[model samples]
Target: MPIDHKQPYDESNIFARILRGELPAKTVFESEHALAFHDISPAAAVHVLVIPKGAYVSWDDFSANASDAEIAGFVRAVGETARIVGAEPGGYRLLANTGKRAGQEVPHLHVHLFGGQPLGPMLAR
Candidate 1:
């Protein structure tokens, strides 16, 4: 189920577990402030998730609390992850579900990078 974006960050969240090396993830890229990995259930031909290293519950929380360096690093990491997934050549889309209403499943803030084929409309009408 989706969760409230304002909910407290769960240390044992799946992503956190993956970060702590207590769970396995198909990692694609890693930097000081972020980690990019293949989504277990990909939504497109190329699907990867990039998340900041900080304990942020949502974009609102992240923007309010993360250091400038952390912000820049996470942004760069997402871009690099897109490149690593070979999506730059074909174009790509970045999606972040901020709250339960937006379909956010994990409490941790994460961006989904999607590409490898035409993604069609930005939103289904």
Candidate 2:
């Protein structure tokens, strides 16, 4: 499934619900610009998600609409979350799936922090 970047942001999306406090999340970090939480279906031992508070559907949307401060803050939050989760030092992978073809299930723009074990190759043969 390929994501249509032109489509409007879905407020009904699960991440949006979590941001609105309508859904529960195991939050790890929160700031004025971003929120970090554990992924319900983690792919790695330490899988966490860092998302901006603003309504942005993808990386393109975020880079285009979000302010510089928002971008910086969000990235910083991701790093901080990685450190808190013990994904730093040893190593970690920060990933953002822009479209459905990239396996982006949620519409909201988010960064996934994966670590705690060797991630291996980025893609399979």
Candidate 3:
């Protein structure tokens, strides 16, 4: 099954529902620009998803032409979410997968924070 990045937020996606407060999420942190929550399908012991609240589909939607405030908010939200998720003190990894080829099951622009347990090669270049 191919993940469609074009249809990032068509309202049917789980993250969309979460953003709209239509679905229940273990919310870690939230600001005007972003929301952070626990991943229902967690890869690590502590997996948090930090996402912007705008209509931007993916990281491309953000990095390509987001405002300075948007970019700053994104970075700050990711850091705040990491701290809230206990990732700051213990250390964590922030990941944003762009397209289908990168294993981005969801199209929304989100940063995944994983930690609590030792995270090796989680972001190996």
Candidate 4:
């Protein structure tokens, strides 16, 4: 489904809960602007998620509402997490699904860094 620009941020979302310490996450990186952790259901040998500390419902919401520093720092954290997980030199794929149809299971804005092996094409033929 296409992202609903009007969708309000859900404080109870899984990512939000993790940020609030209400839920446990195997955190890999944390900064004032972002948080990175391992994905519960990994798609690759190395799969990490980088999320903004703020309440952003999607990538569009993040780009539109977050500060420049926040945006830059969050992206940097994604790279940092990838390198820490040994996914940088081998290469990795960064992805963000904006809505349900795009496979976003949560409402919070997050970037997925996946690598540690040949990831193949973007889609199945």
Candidate topping lDDT: 1
The sequence of per-residue lDDT tens digits that candidate 1 reaches over residues 92-122 is 9999999988889999999999999999998
Q: Total backbone clashes of model 2?
A: 0
lDDT per residue for candidate 2 within 45-78, as digits (tens), equals 9999999999999998999999999999998999
- Could you tell which candidate, 1 or 3, scores higher by TM-score? 1
TM-score of 1: 0.97
* Alpha carbon lDDT of each predicted model: 0.94, 0.92, 0.81, 0.89
Which run of 10 residues does model 1 get worst, by summed lDDT?
81-90
In model 2, the runs with Cα more than 4 Å from the true position are none
Q: If candidate 4 were superposed on the true structure by all CA atoms, what would the RMSD be? A: 1.7
Q: Which clashing pairs does model 2 show?
A: none
For each candidate, how many residue pairs have backbone atoms clashing (under 3 Å)? 0, 0, 0, 1
lDDT of 3 by residue, 51-114 (tens): 8887677888778767888889889989888877777897887788877777777767888888
Better of 1 and 4 by lDDT: 1
lDDT of 3 at 109: 81
TM-score rank, highest first?
Answer: 1, 2, 4, 3
